[model samples]
Target: MSMSTSSMSAMSSAPSAFMTPASATSVLISGAGPTGLTLACLLARQGVAVRVIERAPQPHTGSRGKTLNARSLEVLADLGLAGDLLAEGRTGLPFRRYFDGAFAAESDPSADTPPTPGAPYPASLHLPQDRIEELLRARLAELGVAVEFGTELTGFEQDGERVTARLADGREVTAQYLVACDGGRSTVRKQLGVAFTGTGEPEPAMVVGDLELTGLEPTAWHQWFGPQGALMLCPFGEEGDRWQVQATPETGPDGTALAPSLEGFRRIIARHTGRDDIRVHAAGWLSSWRVNVRMAEQYRVGRVLLAGDAAHVHPTAGGLGMNTGIQDAWNLGWKLGYALSGRARSALLDSYSEERRPIAAWTLETSAAGMAAVREGARTPGVGLEAVRVADITGLSLGYRGSSLAEDLLGGPLRAGDRAPDARCTDAEGRPIRLLETFAGDRFTLLAFGHRPALDPAALDLSAHLRTVTVDTDDPAGLRDTDGHARRAYGIEGDALVLVRPDNHVALTAPRGGEKAVLDYLARL
Candidate 1:
C-alpha cells in the first residue's frame, strides 16, 4: 500500500504558505477524507481559494468505505473522474454464500436491474477507499491544491464574518468559512457544543481488516455462516490474493472480544469455514466495529460547518456511509462557491444544512433498519452476507423535493428539487453529447427544450453564473434529441425550460413563456 508518486509529490509540494495568521482562503477544510477532498475539488474548480488539512501523517491504507453507489458515480462523473474510476473498479460481482462447509447459494445483487439511457451507472463500484482518496488527491493537485497532512486543528472560533482557527503547531489561519470533515469524534463539532444524538450497539460486533489470504477464489465475494459465526472475504484490489475481511468477533471464555491479529483472523477463518488450508499471511487496517447511529443536530454553526462523518455516523450495512458523505460535500460545494463569489447571497448557505441534514437523518434510519434486518436474516438457514445488501442503495431516488430551492412552476413527474436526469443528444456537428457532460462544471446550467428561451441572461442577472443550452427536437441547428430520449426522460413534448443547479439538481422547471419564474427563483437565492 505505497503512496502513488503524484500523491507523494502533492503532499511534499504543499508548504506552510497557508499557516500564517494573515493567510486567507475562501474555504478552510479540516480533514482530507473523501468528504473534505470532494469539497476542495469542487471549490477549486470554481476558482475559490481552498485549503484541505488532514491530521493523519500519511494517506490511509485501509479498505474502508469500499463501494461508491450510482449517485456518487454521477457526482464524480460531473468532475470527470468516473472513467478512470470505472476502469480501476469492479462492478456487478455476484455474492457466493456457504453454510458450514457446504455451498448454499449464489445470487447477483443487481440481477434484474439493467442500465438505462438516462441512468447509465446503475451499479456500485467496489474499490478500496484509499485508492479513491488517491484519485481525489491527484485531481485536487491538478487544480493547484494539495492536502496538508499532519496539520491538526486544535481549536477554532468564528464570528459572523470570518473564522479564525488555531493549529496544533500554534499557527493561526483565517477563512471566510470553515468545514469539519473529521470523523465521528470531531473536534470542530465538539467545540461547537452541538449534540450528536443517537443509539449504539451494546458492544463491538465485528472485526474488520484487509488481508492477503489463500485457499479462496478471487472472482466473487465469499461468505460462510456456521456455528463458529459468520466470515466474509471479499475479493478486492488488483492483486489476486488481496481481500477485505469481516468476521464475527472471536471472544474469550468470559465473552470478552479479542483484539484483531493475523493469527486470530487466521483462526477465525479456519474455524468458521472449516477449511484447514485457508491462511492469512499479512493483515493491515485491523480494527473492531461497533454499530453507532448518530447525526449532528445542526450542520452549521455561524461561519463553521460540519459534514461527512463529522455530521453523522451510522451502521455500514448498506454501504451508505461514504457515499452519503461524498454527496454532502457535493451538495455543499456549489452553495459555498456561490456564497464566497458573491454570485448568490449568503442566505444560500443556509440551504446546505436544510437540504443535507434531512438526508443524513434518513441515512441513519435506513442503515439501522438494514442492520437489524441483516442480523435477523443471518439466523435463518439459507441467508448469508447477501442479507446485508439493501435495495435502492443507489440513492438516485433521494431528492430535495421539499426544499425551498425547489420551484415546481411547471408541474410534472420531473419536478424541481429532483435530480436532473441525463439524456443522449447530438450537437449541430452531429457529435454525441450527454446531458451530464453538458451540465458538468462550476456554473448553473439552463436546459431550454424545443427552442432557445427568449429570456436574456443579462436581464436575469445570471450572466456570470449560468450557462444555457438549447435543445431542438427536429432542427440540426443546435442540440438535437435524435432518439427522443431527452424529451422522454424529461416528460416534455413541447417547449420547456429546466434550471439546473451547479450540483446537478433541478432548481426550477418553467414553460416556454415562464421566463420570469426562473428569474424570480434565482433572485430568491
Candidate 2:
C-alpha cells in the first residue's frame, strides 16, 4: 500500500521516527531557566512531548532578575504558581538611598494602586530569581517533565520537517521544533548564524550577587552613593540579611576592569557607606555582566527558534529580561501545541516571530532608556516607570495590539490583541470563579457577552475545541455578573462577542452578528 501525500506529510513529524516507542518529542528546549521551564511545562501539560536540557549540572542559586511585575505574576497565576509566590514574597520593599551614613530619599518600587475588578494582581513584587526558577521547576515536575542537567545542545541540523539536535554526550534527538532559551551566550543562536546586534557598554558592567550579611536590617532596600562609587543592597529570601549586593568595581590607575570578588564588594560597600558595622558573610553566586543591549536580527531560522535572553538582552532597569522571555514562551507554547496536534495549520507558527520580535525591540528601547535615566539621576523614560510611579514597570499595558491575529471590528477600551482582563464571578452552582480562571488551561475561550446583539448557542457548536462562556446568564456556561465587572470590562451594555486566544489575548471582538467571523477565524486556524 502507498501513503497519501497528506499522510506522508504527517509522518514527517511523527514521533515514531525517533526516541521511545511512544512518540517523537514534539518540542526540544535548550536551557533550564524560567523561560525554558515555563515553555516545557505548558507544552507538556498539553501532553506534547517536550524535553528540556540545561548545561548547568544543578539548579542555580543566584538572585538575578528579581522583580516579578504584575503582568509576570498574572502569567505565573495562569500557570497555577502565583499563589505560592505571592504568599512567599512581599510587595512592600521600599527603595532607600543613604549618603554619608544619613538617609536622603526613600521611594516605593511597587505601585500602591488598588486592585481593580479586571486585574487582581498587585503592580509589582520582589522575589529572588532562584526562588522563581525553583517554583517553575516544581511546576514542570508536576507535569512529569524534568530538566536534563549537564546535557547541552552541542549542535543540530534541521531539514524541511524536523530538527535533529546533537547532545553534548554525542547522542542525537530529533524533534519537530528546537527552542533556544539559553542565555546571552547562546550556542543554538550562534549555530543559527543569527546576529545579536546592538551597542554594548564600552566598560563591562560590575558584579551583582546575593550575600548573607550581619548588621543590616532587611527593613528597606539600602543604597549608599559616596565619593568612591555606589553600592546597593536589597534584602531577599524569606528572612535575614540575605540581600542582593550590586556595586561598581574599584578600578586601578591602569583603567583595567578588575574581576568581581567578595573582598571587592565588601571594600566598595565600606567605602560607600563609611560604616564598619555591616559584615559580609557566606557569599553566594557572583558574576559580572555588561547588559548587552542587543537583540537577534530575527527570532528564528527555520526549525530553530530563540526566546528569553537568547533573543534579546538588555539592562536590568525594568527587570523585563525574564518577563519578556516568559511571555515569549507563553505566546509560542499554545500555537506550537495546537499546530502539532493538527488543530491549527503549521503556518500559524510563523506568527511567533511576527508577534514577538517587535515587542522585544520595544523592550530594548525601554530598558536602555530606563537605565540611562537612572544613571543620570532622572525618572524612567516615558515608555518605562517613574521610580515613584513604578506601575509602568508592571507591564500591564504591553500587548500585541498590532498583531495580525488581532481583529478589531468593534473598537472599545479593550481591543483586539490587548490583554484580556479578568473579572470575578460565580459558576452555575453559584460557586466562586474568576474570569481568569475560566481562561486557564489549554483552550481558546469564546466570551459571549450578555448578548448586546443576542447570540444563540445553536449558532456555533465548537465545544470540542472551544470553551464558550456566556456572561450574564443565557446558557449553561453563563455567569451571573452581580457586580457587573465582566460587563464593564467587556463593554457588555449590549450584545457583543469576544474570542480570546489560548494565550489569553483578545483575537477578535465584533458585534453579535459577527458569529460567522468567529467561526471562520477558528476554521482558518
lDDT of each: 0.85, 0.79
Candidate 2 residues lying further than 4 Å off, grouped into runs, are 1-24, 378-391, 452-461
Tens digit of lDDT per residue, candidate 1, span 370-409? 8777677666666875676465767887889999899887
Give a tens-digit lDDT track for model 2, residues 408-460: 88888889998898899887788878899999988888888775333346755
Question: Which candidate number maximizes lDDT?
Answer: 1
Which residue pairs overlap in candidate 1's backbone? none
- Model 2's TM-score against the true structure: 0.91
lDDT of 2: 0.79
